[model samples]
Target: MLNNNLTWKTSPCSHSEWSQSDLVRGSRILYSQQWTLITDSNDHKSIRTVLPPGPCVPVSGEVLSGLSGHQLLEIWDRHGLRKCLNLTALNKHGRVYDDAQFGCLSWSECENKLLYVAEKIKNTSIEKHDGESPCRKPQQDRSVYCEDWGESLTNKSVPVICVVNLQSGSISVLQGVPHDVSPGQALWAPSSQSVFLVGWYHEPFRLGLRFCSNQRLSGDNLSVSCPRLSPDGSTLFYLQGRVFGPHNQCLSLQQVHYLYLLVVFRLLCSGFPSSLIFFVFVVASSAGFYDLPDYGSWKLLTVQKDLMVVCCSSPNTPPTLRVGFLPSAGETVTWQTLQQPVMTFDFHWTVLDVTTPPEEDNTHYSGLDFGAVLVKPSRPPIEAKTPLVVFIHGGPHSQFPAEWNCTTAGLAKLGFAVLMVNYRGSTGFGQDSILSLIGQIGSQDVKDVQTAVRTALQRDIALDPNRLAVIGGSHGGFLSCHLVGQYPEFYRACAARNPVINAATLLGTSDIVDCVGIQYSYDQIPTAEALAAMLEKSPITHAAQIKAPVLLMLGGRDRRVSPHQGLELYKALKSRASPVRLLWFPEDGHSLSRVDTQADCFLNTVLWLHQHL
Candidate 1:
């Protein structure tokens, strides 16, 4: 007999209800920053804290990547000192942790080896100017995009993959991977010695997955993202921004066997997916499947017998541990939701649609489906149509996951309905949709945002089309400003944090230089026509048309988009006597409105909406 006496309930999400420390980012946001605890399997109740040497707390730092079960590993930066620890016995730091950067962390299959990526720390012998400020000048030879070089945050770091054996305490740096390639998201295969790596290769600057064996990176490769090996070590799962499929004989690419692989190798699209689409494939056979959730973060917690412990979540909920029964020959597959440490599912989710033009409109366009979400407030709005706050995520390449977000919850507390748009080129969707924004940035993206607003007004009775405000950071900021300008009548007010204003002006000064050309379709050196095209595609071009008051929040230490990008937009609007405000965070980098500044940004945006919208 089956019992059915349960229903889900939604609660009022108090923006200021939870403590700051209690609030956590979605799983992907944490990456490898927070402590990962494992419930003792024997008791299934007692928890084990993965602590570092001396039981020090991780402050103002994040974990580099994935965690393996056998032993605990962590990297923390506190008081300008960075430390990487394993089982309290392994600890390594640079002469100065302030300049050190760490990439993803992975455990070898044998449970005795650790693989990670980091920037080689330079000597700590440099003298500060005037013996006071440690502010250093830009290194001319560094790569333009800081993100491409994930190891170093201040500027692109010279990234390298290193492996350490726990038994003998021996460490070896990978020499086979070329100097020009920035390696990231590395994991050990079932063989233990063989590692799969995602590298941002230079020359044309594209991303690809490579195989390494016996300390050598092999030439055989596949352009892939979020590559993962299944527990039995016979299948590989990954998502390509726009592509996929499979066939009969075992063919090897990057030393990994693929029975029937149909690969139309395209240049690696720009930006890693902020969210991921899960795809699983049989390594020894010719079969592949790509039909998992297109939005959210999934992490394999633990595997036992025939049961797989996994945690999955979207923006609306925190990561919940769940149990999945591996598929048998003919038995029905089952998954059970496990309890989460914290409970924060307080809002309601609604579906939204954005119109897409026909293929003849643009051949390179590859968005099979485009969907947005409208999150309503706990209490009904005073007016028939609730005031709306549309949020645009940055990374024209990135997507906003459905996981719990404090910032959005806080705004909803102020009685505003939030709309998140996964516009063209947004990650989580396949590669085709991700690359759709490459050549059609300003117009295509602008149209998509408008379509979302129209869809909300038509479908969601809770949204007030006339009384709307827009908020975003980075590329999101770029679009927020564009929305205020091109569709000036739609948004009442705008708040852009570290926005991209003039791409032509930002090309040389910004760190992600290749990104401008690659995403915007320009040459390394802009000709007169390229400059004109860049200006035309830039949001600043429509500055004169924007009637809304805009709030600008810029990170002074940002290396990716540079504060100048925000400053340029601020000054351009101010020149026309348009209402604007610029707030700067000196200690923060590109991710200004994250941990320390998130609350302030949320509050300020709410206040700005109240005063303007």
Candidate 2:
């Protein structure tokens, strides 16, 4: 029998009967009253304190009154100072944490002494075990570490993992990994003490996983996420198998033909073993299968002595977190349904949490009342006085779903209260709402975010209006730039990453110009006249009006919102004598995929916010 008895409750509005704006205020009030809790169903777990809500905490401070999660591991210890890993290129070159005093030191139960990683001069060879030195097992081959280091891997075209030994001041490279796979998150499995690396590939959106011990691949390669090991290290818990995207490089016929053939071949021959011909045939025969646009599905895979949970979801149905036993043939496996219904956002999303439940209650804010989702921090909330960082998601077509957003979680850990606004023109709310943003960039959509901020402040659920920083990327970056310039008083500072500064310029330079023109029609057509009118709405034109300090970042190979967009705005702002700083990634494209580039973008973004906000 399925465990459908699991209770799922909706959020309650404290003051239901109120005006639109008033209802939004009331909703915020209600959200503040409720406390977020992370529960570990497993017994024998250590309990940590949670951080309180508010914005008084500093970016570098560790105020854990209400934070929770596995990511919070070792956060409260002596390593707290090193919590903000400066993975930026600038900091690495400067050797900011080279000294022993600034480095992290942990007493290992197995090694009996300190273990840590740190930076040193580029050419210096790391000397191992020079007596009472901070380096543990220095004589051990540094290659035993899995991380990649040195100029070769750093300058490589594709993403690679590098492990560094701070004790010996040595760096080693881990090569031969697939170039298509880009590693995003890594952690040591609790149960097996084996390092688990999770990443994605573009062609078909395949997730890769490998278990490494003593710098060696162990066990058959397993694919999973939300991986949890049994307390006794005898089992592994994870989710697997949801094919995302076909083998299409672009939305074209050639790609489709390639993918169709590949799928057929995989089904007919080398793809399946002789043990499961019947099961494979059944899956291959499913109707309307290819019709479903590559919406990914995941199955919970639990690997115990001989058992595993292989939960999966489809585009049209909720996720069935399945429980299965191993060594049995594919079709012979038994299945049981999980209680929670899984929801999928965009594939790239990293953090997910259900905030306001589906059932709606009365709420209002600024003549507009609506339901809201507050992306709570994985760590505890900051003190009341700290600034709130509102991240505007890009793809004006995308909705800020409550999922695993690394950027939001990382900022939350750094003490910023974050809210991902799913304003009008976003997805998930259905097609009508999305179409509303067709020609309305700075219209009701902008008001939605404004209303959200006002609601947050009025209900005492977030930071004061004065302590606000708007940060975003792409279209989101455009909104941030527009927000500061158009509504200068609302934001204290702005951080825009690869923003579309001028829509007029974008319309001309963009590869998808024809597509955008069809989407956002021209109002007054005199060809050049209409284009010029569109330019008036561009943030680049209003650069002078933005009083707040700005930090702009762009990629060199950015063909989407060309680097010229960022550079032109920077130039305009500088000419106006506005406080502005620009950073560029010569080796990067539209987004920062390289670990070093990602780390740099993250660190710089936070530091810039710290300085300005």
Candidate 3:
């Protein structure tokens, strides 16, 4: 039995030091500073300065000193003044910043570059820079291109590519091979100069790499998550599957013996026609069983060369990351565990952060504390110190389990501390919390997450609140959007994948609306007025208020939330000039399954956070 009164403590097994300051840094920093600051730079005059001094870099080649905190100052310089921008301004004199704007300013060396795949959603032709019209007009069979290009990287054509221009919102299609292929995983190499396209065609999977500069195919082979290039792009590593069975002689002998037994059985039973037939049948069946071959679980398939490292996982295991020489098969191939163990945190039957435990035994979950299980980190302390990622599980009625999820585990492996919150309305804590969600979709449930965040911050101050991100699929996605819109200050970024943005739209589009109506006792579905009221509590209605950068992922075939849910909110946010991004997977339904699609979504998410958050 678990102790009910024990106060929750940070995971005792974790080697990393815990600090409250680290966790509360975002909120505390915001509170400690004066809401406004006025700086005078003309006379080298003094003013409040919490600004760290290091690089004297100018913004747009303009330096704006003596600027007030949380207040935007527009000074005339050759270009623009260099000053930190905030999401909100305290006064009308302050320049209100648009979070949605992807400014022309570049920060780090990698700031301006990103690689993504684009497919044609509508039949519309857009002209290319070369004075050629490559876009196909909307029809049933619109051309979809998979190309590798970013603002910083040069464009290249490949055997397979998809291109979407952010500036024009236009899509282009490019195909290398005539054969039809479904992309399994699309990864932009760390250099952001090339892309690796993985797809499944026929029986075996294949991988192809395309360099952006030349639009040339580097290499391709039969495998899943294969042809992984190193950060430097020197080597490729992949996993291969091989089956071992009976030796040739053994197989041949078994065949011969089975044939002999069939003849003998028939001959022996010949005395009685009916008995002979049955016995012969039994003998043949038994002989056939003996001829069955043996097989084994997928073994680590690794190809090592001087230039690259290639490794792959058995379909049963989660995708694994491997390191080796760049571009060539290396002499050594190292497999790194990409999944963390799941931990279950149960708190007062109201909230839980279900997650995978760390890989090592050094992490322990002694007694039940607040119904929250502390997932231990597998990597070293440096990796464990990565930003915390809280997953808001969907299912207003479902609970996030401590089971292994590709998304959670993948994010964890990408140096993120993942917390899957099973707040009010989640199942498994009993029917109470689940039922509590009926009319309290955004209220109490949201509170559960708020409490969990506080609890987590209490345990580890290093948890960068500024770097914190939330991701949710479906209902969880709804929660994510709602959280950002309602409490934009709490999160740095949000990814609402296949989320339900509008309750009314969901009531209309969901297949389970009829069932929901009966449970909630609403008549004739909520009226448009009632629906609007409910939507007022929805993220879609509040999309304009979200201050953090948001990413919205949608599936064209999703019936539960409807792609319109995402589209409507995305459009609203874009119109309001809120920082927002949208990614639509056309061939996919509600959740992504294709390996390539999954990989692309995951990779893009990490990259997005890396850039903005």
TM-score of each: 0.66, 0.44, 0.41
- Among all windows of ten consecutive residues in candidate 2, which has the lowest summed lDDT? 276-285
lDDT tens string, model 3, 1-613? 0000111122101011111112223211111101111233552122222222122221232212234554322323347543332212322122221111111111112433222332223324343333212233334334554332221111222222333233333322333322334332344433443344443331121111211011112123212233344434444443332111100001100111111222112212211111111110000111111111111112222232221111223211332222222222332222222222123222111124432223311122212122332232345255335477778876565555544355665665555667677664565554334444555566666666766776776676656666778888877888888888888888888888888877766665653332122233223556667776567667777777798888888877665557898999888888879888898888766665445566667888888777776
Cα-based lDDT for every prediction: 0.57, 0.46, 0.44
lDDT (C-alpha) at residue 409 in model 2: 59
The digit string of per-residue lDDT tens for model 1 on 1-613 reads 0001111122111010112333355112211122233444673333333222122232323343234631234433346423444532332322111221225567666566677765543324443333111112134423334333321244434455566665666555554444455555666655553556565544343221111010112232333445566556665665332111110011222223322333322212122111111122212222111234533656554443444545577556665554444554554434444344355655676656566756324466543557787777777666577889989988776666666666777677667888899886676666567555666778777788777777788887667768999999888999999999998887899999888888878776664443443433223466788778788889998899999999999887776677988888888889999999888888766767446576667668888999987
Q: What order do candidates take by lDDT, descending?
A: 1, 2, 3
Q: lDDT tens string, model 2, 422-482?
A: 7755666554455455555654556667666666666544455677998998878988898
Query: Could you tell me which 10 consecutive residues in candidate 3 have the lowest summed lDDT?
Result: 244-253
CA deviation > 4 Å runs, candidate 2: 1-372, 376-384, 514-526
* Model 3: how far residue 256 lies from native, Å: 52
* Runs in model 3 lying further than 4 Å from the true structure: 1-385, 514-525
